[model samples]
Target: MKSPSPGRSSAVRSMRSAPFFTPIRVVFSFAGPSARRPLSFFSPTIRPSAWRGRPWKALRLVPLLSQNFKAEVVAVLMLILFFSWCYCSYVLGCWRLNIALSWFWWRHLDAGLHAVMHGDFRTRHDIQAGLFWIYSLLSHRAMEYYYGARELKGNGMSKHWWHHIYPNDPGRDPDWSTMTGVAWVRRHTSAQWHPCHQWQCWYWLPVSMFLEPLFELIQVACALLEAVASLLEPPMNGPYVSRWAHVLGFLCEVLFNPGFQLVAFGVQPFWKALGVLLLARATSRLLLYPFSEVQHYMPEHILNREAADDSAEWVIGQLLCTANLEFRNRWAWLMDFLMFHGDSHQIEHHLWPAMSFVQYTKASQVVRATCARLRLPYYTVGYFEGYQKICEQVKEHRKPPPRPKRPRSPGEEPSPSESSSTRTRRRTRGS
Candidate 1:
């Protein structure tokens, strides 16, 4: 077989990288903030502007979204990169980069450095997040099987093992943790639950879409910084990386990161490189943002914060606190093929992390039916409905249901159904 071309490999890598949108999706979402309007490519009207200034306005955009298949395809791919660059802030004047979240991360990382000096933390929080990886992988098992880093059993405390082992413990279950944003809840949060949490419903979707791309960037930066910091730590604390090894690892960090790696994936021209990386990274991140925050971030997940630890067996714990979705959809295989698989069947993935994407459907069915037989919660919600539920929960979070009073008279105690009604009324009043 002929060797795969660099561009072909790059295309695959870019798709696998988180962050993207189809060119069509971008055009529709391109209305200005002030005159907000969705794209109308599907509409007979070519121009979707509220101003109705130029009916031909969309004609200029037509080359980018043509009727011709190959041209349209190319245009769409370019738009993904263009918009990704716009959102990722690789170029300015496209869109705002690092809005509400950039400051948050800045402060968070600053506090981390401060902790390295004082404030009860042993190491910088930034470094702590990384646990000091010279280079990281999407799956550490891939690292072990292919790269022969067999010592990294689940990458030793940084990977999903902690989440599987600890489930929903705020400290250990990485899935059940929050890195930043307002600290809510009286128990686990650094800040008291604020009235503002009610407005999260309003802001989270748009803000998360904007802020999510930076999340991976910030995470990688911290990881690399910790790796650098590790080099300075005592040998007992740091991995023994020789000078040559350090150089190689540093290159790997830059080249292996999804963003930079996408850029370097192909032997294409500069613009093509940018476009490819832009398409894959931005589209992946954009589609991922809405669902990503909702995962393990529903209101019930937060209410469980009263407990510091969990005792459920690992499998059951995953079923209890984690959620699943109706992944048996048209796009399930496409998502799987693109390498961001099984998230729609998140519980199944956790239960069998290394299972092939092709096998996930059967595995999911087995797990779901088994969990149902055992009377465990094995939720499988539609994609849009799942997001809708999460949005509703965010709005309702501030107003918890009122507690029922004990019976004073023989018949004073509310029955189970009555208690539910009374609770509903209180919740309504609180809202």
Candidate 2:
């Protein structure tokens, strides 16, 4: 074996000295309400380091329980701003700002999904109604129409936890289904390869970036079918199982909802309304997808549960699987805003899933320094570098896997050369 460089050897020694997987002791104080309850954590938590204090305390700088209303307020404000923007752009004919406002609104709503994890929003009903209305009216998604506020919040939290629990684990992580290219476009994992994926690297960018409308339309079509089914025979599960609510929700999605933006656009033609809706969704996806994907798509980080070393500490697995975007001091806030907050500092988000983005920003320094001191892998890349990294990963998987030769037809025997080579290969595998 070749000898490692002096720097590489020293790095290895540091990592070995401070192992990544450190046992975590969690102590829960059950005296208070579940949301307000304080969790006492012993150190060497997440990963081994000299630090002995509660890591959650550092991450949650804000009074999350008391300040949840503030998050709800922000959500309401975002909804107002989006509608206000829609009025100015769509009604007043300032259509150039359409994509920009829609994109911002979409990002905020997407972040609202994260905000829901924090829990106990007094305005949950209002917020959920606004969100459902926005998606249904603008994106023509009937499924959103069916789900009420509580269901939306529950589903969002469950999915978020699942993704964090198994970040970057193909077949296990729910996000993988979306990340591994939609429809025919495939980003092959090591365990799964297909010939179509050979050209994925070449066309993925253009297709994903520009053709979001087509995908959105497909989703809308599927949702429409689902909506019909629900109306005819309501789901046996979920709060809104009644056929009456299904009919009402479907009506709200289509024509009767006060939240519909087309009315503000002033009696626009059906095609025009649909065109605007598609354009909005397409632009939002373009702005959001590329940045949102950067955290998990790093080739080296995507691993199975066994390979991820989950036995050590799940938090260690999170750190390994997730990456962050490096931002300059002056532009960190801007990047955070653009990346839908907390997403730029995804390691912290994964570490403290319940904490808000404000806390993520505040605690990012502590987390980064902790990782550095512990000799843990804390991946961060520039925006361009991260995007290029994703493309490189796709390109790396572009080669089609070698296939075995077809068996000799029915009764026919293989050639003598083929039989001998097969026998030798089988023996080698056995040995």
Candidate 3:
């Protein structure tokens, strides 16, 4: 076989260096208000001193459903860099770079979606819809894998807003159990409980870690089917179907889909690179989900519609449903940083969804102090403690729920069925 091109090798090497360089670059560019600089590129162009002691003011600083255009553009460029690395590594058979880049891809998976969620970069004339249309093509690689291809008007923002509206309601929350595997193994709500879930606490952590790649594959297949179906039907257009539409839809869904570009699979080197990709996907989820998943649906928050307090004040309801991850050490903070602080200060994020991640540090302080003063539940558990608590919650609900006792008037005799059962129990005990 001819040796791989030297230029390709050099490009792969350069791409591999991104894992090291990007974080440092991102740290400097996205620096928090506490940094010596006036303000960082990633934050909104506001005075650094304006960030202190005024979380409510910070909320007013950014309008609802708005984002910093330039900062979000830079974030998108970072996403593209990581995505390009994944593509090149796969095509060029650079397994090491491919494996390394997969983690970067998974780490930024939420960040990518959130960037799009936060802003449209002030685009014009339905361009934001087109942007989502394009992102919907690639979003399956993220944790919100299924339903990645949403209707233009009904894209992630709508879906996310729906989640906020119903946070942990049993049936209404779209994110209740997006991962089908977790839905089976653990009950995020009492309604989700099954007898089989009893064993989940023991095995779920290990087993679900490897299932991420499997979930990815399933999501890719689902996206392909959806793409083909959408093309054939061509929503809102006339119902006249053509034969060429069928052929082109099949080709695009199988061949051109960003999630599963199949051209390199015929090559031997692709298999090695694929293994790394799968491993990276699995490993990243293994590390990331414990931090991310524990943010909501804890034991105290296992609410169904009937039991949920829909009438509660908005901020209190948000606080009740969302929990923040606390980092006690530098290592934990590093992990939080890698997660884009999405899990840390989650309570603040839920309360003020439009605030930039860089603004979270100051916002969290204010939120924490106010929660303390008001004596509201401010759940900020250490990373491992949060993980274990969520697992314990799963275990606690594994058994069947205890039967509610029948109420009776004073000195009332048992009903016929109840008396017969009581006699049978007496006879069995005597025997």
- TM per candidate comes to 0.45, 0.66, 0.62
Lowest lDDT block of 10, candidate 3: 33-42
- Which candidate has the top score in TM-score? 2
Off by over 4 Å in 1: 1-159, 179-202, 215-247, 260-283, 301-315, 337-341, 352-357, 372-375, 397-431
- Residues 2-34, candidate 1: write the lDDT tens digits: 111222222122222324322211212212221
Give the distance in Å from residue 264's predicted Cα in candidate 3 to where it truly belongs.
5.7
What is residue 351's positional error in candidate 2, in angstroms? Answer: 0.9
Candidate 3 residue 167 Cα shift, in angstroms, is 2.0
The whole-model C-alpha lDDT of candidate 1 against the native structure comes to 0.40
Q: Write the per-residue lDDT of candidate 2 for residues 26-144, one digit (tens) a residue.
A: 01111122212111111123233322346433433433232355545655565666667756765665556765566665555445544442321323444433443343333333232
Stretches of candidate 3 above 4 Å error? 1-70, 73-77, 120-137, 140-157, 178-183, 188-198, 211-216, 229-270, 303-308, 329-341, 403-431
The TM-score that candidate 1 achieves is 0.45
User: Which 10-residue window of candidate 2 scores lowest in summed lDDT?
Assistant: 21-30
Separate clash counts for every candidate: 14, 0, 0
Cα lDDT tens digits, model 3, 132-224, are 333433443331332222122123333455566567654666666553333656554435556667777777765666664567677767765
State each model's CA lDDT, in order.
0.40, 0.51, 0.51
| Cα misplacement distance, residue 166 of candidate 2 (Å) | 1.0
